[model samples]
Every structure is written in C-alpha cells, then in structure tokens.
Target: MSKSSHRDPLSDTQLRVKALESVLLEKGVVKQETLDAIIDNYENKVGPHIGASVVAKAWTDPDFKSRLLENASDTLAEMGLSGIEGTHVEVKENTAELHNMVVCTLCSCYPWTLLGLPPTWYKSTPYRARAVRDPRGILAEFGVKMSENVEVRVWDSNAEIRYLVLPIRPAGSEGLGEDELAELVTRDSMIGTAVVEMN
Candidate 1:
C-alpha cells in the first residue's frame, strides 16, 4: 500500500511549536538552555504523578481528604505542590450520586504542575464547547458510562482558578498502599475524562 498523504495534526502542531521555539531563540526572547531546562522539568521532573500522589494520600487518609475538599489550594501547597497555573485549585470528588468533570471553556487553563500539560483534546474547540453542552456524551466518548441516577457536573476552568477531579476510589483497592494506589490514578481520571479501573 502507498503511504497516506494525510498528515497527523499533532505532528503539524509539534512542527509549529518547534518553529516558534526557533524564532524565539533567534530573537533572543528566550535562551535555548532555558527552554531545554523547562522542557526537561516538565518532561522528566514534573507530571501527573505528583497529582497522583496527592490523590493516593486523600484515598488513604480521611482527614487529608476532608481538608483537600475544604480548601484545595492550601492543602496542595501544604505538600509543596504549588506553582503558576496551580495557585488557585479546586478539587471536586466523584461520588455515587455525582460525577465531576473539568473543562476550560474560555481557554486551556489547567493545573500544569499537577496534570503536566493539557491533552490536545482538552484544548480543542470542540471539547470546550461540547463538554458543557453534552457532558454525558463527552464522557461516553471518553469511555465513561454512567447511570441516569448519577449527576454530571462540568466545571469551567478559567484564569482565576482551575479544577481537578478526585476520582472515586475503585473497589478492591482497600488492600493497596498509597504508592500502589497512586499508580492506579491516571491523568484522565483526575481530569474527569475517565475513571480508575482495577485492570
């Protein structure tokens, strides 16, 4: 078969980012070493695992969970997990009666320190518009099926604050330790696009 002519949009986006980086370097707007260090930090040093650790702690400790729900920014900062785009964070917990999802309707304002970077879908115009219009449909697309009895709440993130979803602790997780539970928590789950499954 001949190679397809269609190009991947993500590849195109990566190329654009590279071009922008090159232009910035040429203009001396940013140093290559600075860019490299920032990339290294996001790629190797920081990611969703930090948020996963917090979720695991909340799962294991009721007191911490209570505090997290009451005041997310302070609670998260207490663990030294605060930074730009994370200064104001609100956490919503998933329960039997309600499911929480986060979306930046205005733009892709997200908790980068905790969630790494927003997924391309999260930053798309369609997702921003549809998530609020038809959350259940969006959830279904994300492979999350919910009963009619459960309420779906879609929170709009903005410049003032960002949201995180505290996914429900899955069944059969009682035997797991904090570290093990953290492994089960995924970036999508925390974003409310998916849930944590035992498998």
Candidate 2:
C-alpha cells in the first residue's frame, strides 16, 4: 500500500511522543519495573538532586548563598549542575515582614535544579489564577498564615528567568547544619505554600 493511501497510526506529534514513550517504557522494562520506577529514578536520583544540594550548601555557606543570589547560573554551574532551561534563576528570600511567592503566570517556569518536577497544582489553571489574585488565601490553605502586616509579593516567572523562594529558616533550627537545613527546605516552602518550621 502506498504511504499516503494507508492509514497512519500516528501523526507527526504522535510519532515523536510515541518514540519517547517507547524509549521510556523500554528503559523501565529493562529495569524490571513500571514506568513510575523510571520516573522515580530520574526524580530521586538525577533531576533536581543538584538543586537540593545547592539549597543545602546555601544553608551552610554564606559565601555560596551570596554568589547564588548574585548570579544563580554561575553558582549552579560551579556546583556542576547546568543546561536546564531557565539557567537564569533568581532567588528571592522571604523575610518575616515580607513574604514572596513564585508562579509562572504564563507557564510553569521553575528552577528544576532546586525544584525538581513541577507539581500538578503548579501548572493548574486554578493555581495560576488564584496565586496572583488571592496569594495570602492560597498560602493560608497550605497552613501558612502570615501576619496581617506581612506583605505578600507574588512573582510571575516569565520567559527570561525562573524563580526560587528562599523561605525563612525555622526558629529552632539555629544550630542546624547544612544537611539538616536542606530537609527543612520543602517544595512547599520554596513555592510559598508553606513555611519551614522546626518540629
């Protein structure tokens, strides 16, 4: 049968998508598990693991945090993690009187090194809409109740650069080391949904 005359099982986009899917499926099958294993391998093993490391380093090393705040790309590369989109990352610190929240108003632009994969809610229309309109209320839903006087500044990550929130370190974590501090920097803390609190 002529190519044009035959029914194509896949369109151009479908062909590309299927090709990637097949590779991922094969990788998972070879690893003797479901696709989730492969995803977990990347999420837990490779992707954004560097970001967690960076957060840890920043927590301990003041010099590194200064460098990261000055220029994220250089600092990240210095730590041997680079090449993701949004190499231009801006770190915003949340203080007691001022809180900062990050959202990709146009799309889900995030610093993957520090944030790993974007959560479903991060990309949802409801979050995108509500984050800008009722940021405090949205944060409240996640159990982060800010003081009435605290100003909430919502940042919209655009095409140029991505954002990572530096949440205020918990009070009791005064003597914590880098490793301990990293554990406190939850994804919610970075996203401004919750604050980092010591138990």
Candidate 3:
C-alpha cells in the first residue's frame, strides 16, 4: 500500500496545523516537546477514550443515550468532554438495519474534541469521495462485512458539525460493566468503519 498523504502530498488541514504549531513554537507558547506530547496523547491516550466512554455510557444508560442522541454537544458537556471547537455534534446509530459512515469531502472536519485528530486516510481525497459514493465498499475494505439487508448511511463531516457513529454492541456483552464496555469501543467503530469486536 502507498504511504499516507502526509509525506506524499500534504492535505490543507495538515499544512494549516503545521503552520499553527510553528507559530506557537516561535512565540514560546508551547515547547516542541510539549506539542509532540500533546499529539501523542491524542493519538494514543485521551481522545478516542472520550468517545468510547460516551458510547459505553450510551450502551449502559438509557437516559444519557437519549440525551446524547437528542443533543450531543450539550450532553457531552455533562460528561465534561465538550469544548475544543466542538460546538456541534450529531450522533448517528448503526443498528441491525442501518449502518453509518463518516467522511469529510472537503477537509478533515471531525469531532476533534472527542476523537482527537483524524487519521491520515480520513484526509485523503480518494477516501472522502469513495466513502460517500460507496460506503459499503469502503467498510469492506476496512474489514466490516455486513448482510445485504443492512442499509448504509454516509454522513459528510464539515467544520460546523461532525458525526460520530454509535456502533451496535456485540452480543453477550450485557454483563460487561461501563469500563469493560468502553474498552471494547475502538476509534474505527465510532467512525463507522468497523464494529466493536466482542473479544
């Protein structure tokens, strides 16, 4: 497979982020190490866990789930996971009959507050165009096989509003606690590309 667009061809958002980081470094607002740590934290530690926790709570708590479904931007504040340019968020459900996929056709507009940074593939033009045109095909490429009856729903992310997919919890997970459930939620699942594996 070819390398990510980062090295071969940088996306606009990537360039902007780099420019901002450079300005901040020049002003001494943050050290290079600090910036690197923050990126590492988002890429590995904190970001995706926030979204996973939301999904896990939705799985366990019906009231929060309802509130989340109704207004994620506000409901997320209750969990202290709001802010960071997340003024609007739309939560979509992936059920037995419906499947959801997220893409940003223009830029890498995503729920950065909850999901951290978008993956390199998410910023690719090919992925952006292909996701909306053939969501099931993209899902299959991601190893998400679905039955023919499942209707695929693709949501194009933008700067003002972003989408998060609440994937269907696997069977036999009824006994799992909130933390255990959160552990099962992956970044791709919330992106609607893959389902949460029970194991």
Candidate 4:
C-alpha cells in the first residue's frame, strides 16, 4: 500500500514523544506500571476530587479557608497537589453578589492537577471569547441562572496562573463534615461553570 493512502495512527510529534517514552521505559528510567499508575491517578484519584477536598476543607475550617484565600498554591502544595499546570492556583470565592468564571484566552491552560484535562468546551475558542464577552449568557447556557443584581466576574487562565472557584456552601450543609462537603462539590463548581448542588 502507498504511504499516502494510509493515515498514520499517530502524528509525527506524537510519534516522537512515544519513541522517547519507549526509550525511557526500556532503560528503566520510567516503569510501565508507574506510567499506568500515573494515568490511573489522573483519570480517577486526581481531578475534581482534589479540588473538592480543598473546597471542603475551606468550608469546614476557617483558618484553612483564610490561608487558601490568601495563598492558594502554597496551600495546595501542603495538600500534596501540585503540577506544571497547577503550579499556581488562585481561588475566587463565590458570594451572593459576585459570581466568578474562568477562561483561557490563549490556550487551554488549566489546573490539571485539580481538574484533570480541560473539558472540550473550555478549550474551545468560542468559550474563551464568549466567556469574556458575555459571561452571564455562558452561565445561562450551563443552566446557572442568577438575578440581574448579581455581578459576573470572568478570570483568564494562562501558563503562569489558574483559577478555582470556592463555591458557597449550601445552607443545609452546615452540619456536614469535610468528606460530606466534598461530596457536594463538583468539577463544574471548581471551574466556576456551575454551583455545587446541596443535596
């Protein structure tokens, strides 16, 4: 078969990365099981769970909440959450009057350590543009409706920094423990795209 007639399974750059990974694996510099473990962690244990843990701690601990609001990245590190994409995190608290949202105008720079990979819509150009131009409309599209009196704040994520929304604790959740509170937190809430459901 002609080379041109068959599409390559991997892109040239992707193939190069794979080749490098293979070499490292063969040399025992990187174990296959370790690689699989890392993937499994990101696919399951990491992502919103980490963010939710942080949020729940803040909701349940006043001092920790103050520390998180004052210096988020350091606080995250204390919790064993840090990565290239999450080297810096800034928490934006959602209040009765102000609602926060995040967008990456340049690219899909995100808190991968806390949210796994960026969602497709979040990485799209339309989201980047529309979020800055019409945040309320975007929120509405996500089924997040707020009164006109509420203000919408849009944050831009870049290589240097990322944003996480500290959603308001539901009124009925006051008796909940940190773990229970964490259960109430959601990926969308961490991304400022939706509110954490109380129930």
Q: Estimate each model's TM-score.
A: 0.86, 0.77, 0.80, 0.83
Indicate whether candidate 1 or candidate 2 has the larger TM-score.
1
Q: Which residue ranges in model 3 land beyond 4 Å of their true spot?
A: 1-45
Of the candidates shown, which would achieve the greatest lDDT relative to the real structure?
1
lDDT value, candidate 2, whole model: 0.77
Per-residue CA lDDT of model 1 for 72-128, tens digit only, reads 999989888888789889999999999999999988998987888887999999999
Model 2 C-alpha lDDT per residue in residues 1-199, reported as the tens digit of each score: 7774665665577777777778876767444355677677456855444555566677778998888889987877766665565478888778878899989888888777567778889999989988989998898788878888998999988777878777787888879888777776778777778887786
Clashing pairs in 2: 51-113
Residue 177, candidate 4: C-alpha displacement in angstroms: 1.4
Q: Order the candidates by TM-score, highest first — what do you get?
A: 1, 4, 3, 2
Cα deviation of 37, candidate 2, in Å: 13
Q: Name the runs in model 1 displaced over 4 angstroms.
A: 1-28
Clashing pairs in 1: none
What RMSD, rounded to one decimal, does every model reach? Answer: 5.9, 5.9, 6.4, 3.6
TM-score of 2: 0.77
Q: What is the lDDT of residue 48 in candidate 4?
A: 80
